[model samples]
Target: MVSAFAITRFASGLISGTLVDKFGERAVFSSGVFMVALFTFLAGLSQSYEQLLFFRAAGGLGSSMFSVAAGSVILRSVDDANRGRAQSVYQGSFLLGGIAGPAIGGLLSVISLRAPFFVYSGLLLCSGMVAFFFLKGDKIGKEDKNADISEHTTVREALAMKPYRIALVLSFIGAWVFFGLRASILPIFVTEELNSTTAVVGYGLALSAVVQGVILLKAGRYSDEKGRRAASIIGAQVVLLGVLLLTFSVNFWMFLLSMAVLGFGGAFISITPASIVGDVIKGKGGKVIAIFQMAGDAGMMVGPIIIGAVSDLFSYRAAFGMSAAIFVIALVLVYQIPETRNVEGPQVKNLRPLDEDL
Candidate 1:
C-alpha cells in the first residue's frame, strides 16, 4: 500500500509532460506504455513488497507520462470549441479506471496479485503500439525547436494568472478531500461507524463510481454551454452535501446517498480543471501543461499523507469534516477565478491565430 502507487502516481504528470514537450507525444506515449508494460509484467514476477513497489513506481511514471503528454496533445490538437467534449472523455477515463481497476483487481486477485500486473502490461503495450502508428497529426516536430514556451513560462507564471492560480489551489484542496476519504477514512466509516459489511462497502463504492461516471458525461456537456464557474458552484455544493451526509449518516440509505453526492460533486472538479489548464497553456502546449499536471499530482500525493495522518491520530468524523473544509476552500478559490467561457478578449485573438479549425 505504501509503495504500490503513492510515490509513482505523484510523479506521473511532470515526467510524462516533459517527455511529451521534449520528445513529442507519439514517442513519449509509446515509451511510457512500454515502461508500464515491462514493469507491470516484472511486478507480477516479484515475490517481495519492496520489489513490487519498484516495479509499480516504474509503471506509474509510464502511466503518468502518457497522461501528461497525451492530455496536452489532445488539447492542442483541437480548437477551443471542442475542448470541453475532449476533456470530458479524457477526464472520464480516470473515473473509468477507478471503477474498472478494483473490479479487475478483484477478479485477478483471486488468481494472484501478480495476475493484474501482466494484464496491465499487455494493455499498455498494445496502446503504445497503436499510438506509434496512428498519431499522424503530431506537430511537435514542426514547431519552433527553441520555442519560448519553456524559458518564458514558469510555475510562477501559472501562479500569477489569477484564474490558473485559483484552479491550482482548488485542485489541491479538492484532491485532498476526495482522495483522503477514499484512502484513509471511508473504510473506517463503513466498518466502525456504520457497521457495514465488506460487501456493502464494495457495492456502495461501485454505485458511487457509476454515478460519478454519469455526472462526468452530463456535466461536461452542461459546462460547455454554461460557464465553468457555474458548474463549480453547484459541484462544490454537491460535495459539501455529500461530506455532510458521511459525517451525519445514520444508516445504509444515508451512506448510499452520501456516495452519490460525493461522486456528483467530484465529477465537476475533475472536468473543469483539465479544460481550465488547457486554456492557460494555449501556446506552449506540452511544457506548460506538464507543469499544471505536475502541480495536480503533487496535490494528490500530499493530500493523503497530510490528511490521512491527521485522521489517523484523530477521529474519522473529524477527518471527513476536515475534507469538507478543503472543498470550501476550493469553492472560494473558484469564486475568485475569472470564467473562461466564450473567451471574449483581444488577448485571446492575438495569442492564438486561427491557422486551422477543428
Candidate 2:
C-alpha cells in the first residue's frame, strides 16, 4: 500500500498535464478535488486494508489531476503582462494550503481522524467555487479559423527545441532539490540536528512557506520586466548557499535561519520555470505548461531516491552536500541558458498571394 501511493502519484502527474489541454482548467480542476474528497471520505468508512489502499491511489490521481488543470487555468487566464504575478499568487495559495492542511488535520484528529475528511471537503469545495467563477479559457480559440492559433506540438517536438530541452532538465533539478528531502529521509536531519518537536517542525516549515511566498510575489514582477533568467540564477545561488550553510551550522537558531534561506531559494520554483517555458512557447500556453510540470515531477521522483540512498551510505550532511553539487550544476545551466525576453517576439505578417506556401 505504501509503495502503491508513490507509484500512483508519479503516474498521475504525467497524465494530468496532458488532460488539462482538452478539458480546460475549470472542469478539470474542480472535479479532481471533488473526486479526492469523495473517495477519501469513503476510505474513512473502509473496513479493510484493501479498501483503504484503493482510496489512497484514487486520492493521488485526484491531486495530480488538479495540478494539471489549475496550472493551465493560471497560464491561460492571465495575459503576458501579468502572468508571473498571477502565477505567484496562484502558487502562494498552495503555501496557504500547506499551512492549513496539516494544522487543521492535526486539530481535527483530536476530535476524530474522520473529522479531517470533512475539513478537506469544505476547503476544496470553496476553492472550486472560486475557480469556477474566475477562471476563463479560450479553448474555442484553439479551433478558430481566423485566430492563427498554432498547432499543438507532439512530445517529441517539444523535446527537440533546444531551449525547452534545457528548461526540462533544469526543472527536474529544481523539483528534486525543493521537494525530495522533505518526506522519507531529510526529516531525520531536522529532528536530530535541530532537536525540535512537532510544533517546531510545523512552524519552521510554515516560516519557509511564508517567507518564500513574499519573495516570490516580488520576484515574479522582476522576472516579467527584467527577464526570468536573472530571477532563477539568483534563486539557485541562494539555494546552493543555503545547502552549504545547512552542512556547517550546528546551533539550533542557525538551523532555523538556514531554513529561511532555503525558503528564499524555494521562491523561484514556479515563477522561474513557468516564465522560461512560457517565453519559449509564446502562444501555446497549455502545452508548454504541461511540459514544464512534467519535468518537475521527474525531478521530484529521481531526486529523493538518489538522495535517500546516499544518506543511507553516508549521512544527511552528505546527502545535502550532494544536493549542493546538483544545485551548482543548476546554477551553471541557468546561467548559460538564454533569456527568453531578450529574444524578439515572433513576427506576424499576412502571407502574400504570390507566396508559394500560401
Candidate 3:
C-alpha cells in the first residue's frame, strides 16, 4: 500500500510540475488539494483492502500535484531577499502539522477508525477553498517584473548551473537522511539495538521534531543573512556528526542527543536547498522545481530500502556509516557551489537554450 502511493506520487511529479507551469499555481494547487480530499474521503468509506489501496494510490497523484504546485507557489511569490525565511515558515508549518496530525488522528479514531480520514478530508477541502480564494492575481510578488508570465527557466537550464546541481544533491541527501532513514530505521534500531521500548522511539522522534521546529526560523534567517553555501555546508557537517554519533551510540541518552543534533541540522537542510533553487530560477520554472521536488521524493523512496538492506546484510553501524559517507560527499559539493544570496531577478545569465544542450 505504501509502495503504491509512493510509486504513483513519484511518477506524477514531472507532469504535475508541467501542469503548474501551464495553469498557474492557484488552479493547480486548489485542484490538487481537492483531489486529495476527494480520494481520502473515498478511502475512509472503503469496505476492503483493495479499495483502500486504490484510493491511496490515486491520492498520490494529487499529493504530487499539491507538492509541486506548493513549491512553485513559493518560488513565484517569494523574492530572493526573504525566500529563506519564507521557506522556513513554510517548512515549520509542516513540522507543526506533523506533530499535531497523529495526535488528532488518534483522537478522531476513538470516534471511529475512519473518522480521522473524513476529518482530514474536510480540512483539505477547507484549505483548497482558502487557496482558491486568497491566491489571487497572476504574479503575487512585487519583485516579479517579468512581463511575460509564460517565461520560465527550463530543467536543462537549471541543471546547467553549478549551484542548482548542488542544490539537487542537497535536497536528495536531506530527504534521504532526515525524512526516510530516520523514520524507517531509527525506531527499529532503538528497540533492537538500544534495548529500548517503542515509547522511547516516540519520545526521541518528538524531541527531534521539537528541536528542529525551534531552530527553523533561526536557520532560515541565517541562510538569508549568511548565504546558502554556508548554511548547506554547516548543515551537511552537522548531519554527518549526528549520524556518526548515532552509529556509535550505546545508550538512550546518546541516541536522543543524536536525534537533537540531526534535528538542528535538518532545519538548515530544509531551508537552504529550496532557497538555492529559488535563487537559481528567480521566476516561474515549474519543470525545474518539479525536478528538484522529485530529487527529494526519490531520496525519500530509495533511502530506507537501500539503507535497510545494508543493515540486513551487514550491521546498523555500517548502514549509518554509509549515510555519513554520503553526507561527506554532499558537504564537499556544497563547497564547490557559489553562494546564492545575491543571485536575484529575472535576467539570469549564461543559461543556454533548453534544446541546445539536450
Candidate 4:
C-alpha cells in the first residue's frame, strides 16, 4: 500500500517539472498544495484500503508538484548570492516539519488514528492559501507576465549541461543512501546489530533530525559564501565517514554519534545541489529541477530493495558498507563538477541556450 504512494510519487516527479514550466510556479504550487490538502482529507475519511491507496497516491502527486514548483519559485525569487540561503530555508522548513509532524501525529493518534490526516489536511490547506497570496504574482526574473514557455530552455538542453548532470547524479546517490536505505534499514540495524531498543533507535533518528536542522542554515550560507563545490565535497566526505562509522559501530553511542555526523552531512547535501542548479539555470527551472528530483525519487524507490537483498545475502554491515561506497561515488562526482556559485548572469545565458521550439 505504501508502495503505491512511492510509485506514483516517482512518476509524478518525472513529469511535474514539465507541468511547472507549462503552468507558472505560483499557480502550480498553490494548486499542488491544495490537492494535497484535499486528498489528505479524503484519505482520513476513507473506509477501505482501496480508497486509502487512491488518496495516498493522489497526495503523492500533489507533493511532487509542490516540491518542484516551490524550488523553482525559490530559485526564481532569489539572486545567486542568496540562492543557498533560500534553498536552505525551504529544505529546513521541510526538515522542521519532518521532526515536528511525527510528534504531533503521535499525539493525534492517541485521539484517533485518522486524526493526524485530517489535521494535516487543514495545515496543508493553510499553507496553500499562504502560497497563493504571499508569492509574488510576477515570474522569477522576467518583466513580461505572459511570456511563452518556448522562450525558456528545454528539458533536453538542461540535462545536457555538465553541472546539472553532476548535481542530478549526486541527488540520486544521496537519496538512495540517506532516504531509501538508511532511513528504512537503520532502525533494524540498530535493533539487530547493536542490540538496542526501538526507543533508542527513535531517539537516534530524532537526534539526527535536530542536528540536521541546526546546521542547515549555516550549511546553506557556507555554500553561498564559501562555494557550492566546497559544501558538496565536505558534505560527501562527512557522509562517507558517518556511514563507515555506522558500518563498524558495535555499540549504541557509536551509532548515535554516527547519526549526528550524518545529520550535518545531510544538511550540506540537501542545500548545495539545488543551489548549484539554481546558479546555472536562470529561467524556469521546471525541467532541470524535475530531472534532478526524478533521479532522487528513482534512488528512493530502488535503493532499499536492493540493499535489503544484500543484507539478506550477507549481513547488515555489508549493506551499510555498500552505502558508504555510494557516498564515495558521490564524493568523486562532486569533486569533478565545477563550482557554479560564482557564475555570472552572462554565463547563465551561455550555460542554457534558449530552445525556440521549447
Regions of candidate 3 where Cα sits further than 4 Å from its true position = 140-151, 343-358
lDDT of each residue in 9-80, candidate 4, tens digit only: 778885778778777787788888999999999999999989998999888889889888888887767777
Instruction: Give each model's whole-structure lDDT.
Output: 0.72, 0.70, 0.84, 0.82
Worst 10 residues of 3 by lDDT: 140-149
lDDT of 1 by residue, 1-358 (tens): 5545656756556656556656787788777778878988898899897887788777778877777767767766655555666777877787788788878888998998678878877887888898888865735433456444543355567767877777677667776677767776687778878888777788778887888888787787776767678777777888889998888887888998999888888777777777676566555456567666666666667777776677778977777777777777877777776787664522242143345332
Candidate 4, run of 10 with poorest lDDT: 344-353
Model 3: per-residue lDDT, tens digit, 180-219?
Answer: 6676788889999999999999888999899999999999
TM-score of each predicted structure versus truth: 0.89, 0.86, 0.92, 0.92
Q: In angstroms, how far off is 37's CA in candidate 3? A: 0.3
Clashing pairs in 4: 150-358
Best by lDDT: 3
Better of 1 and 2 by TM-score: 1
Measured with C-alpha atoms, the lDDT of residue 203 in candidate 3 is 89
| Candidate 1, residue 252: how far the Cα is off, in Å | 1.7
lDDT of 4: 0.82
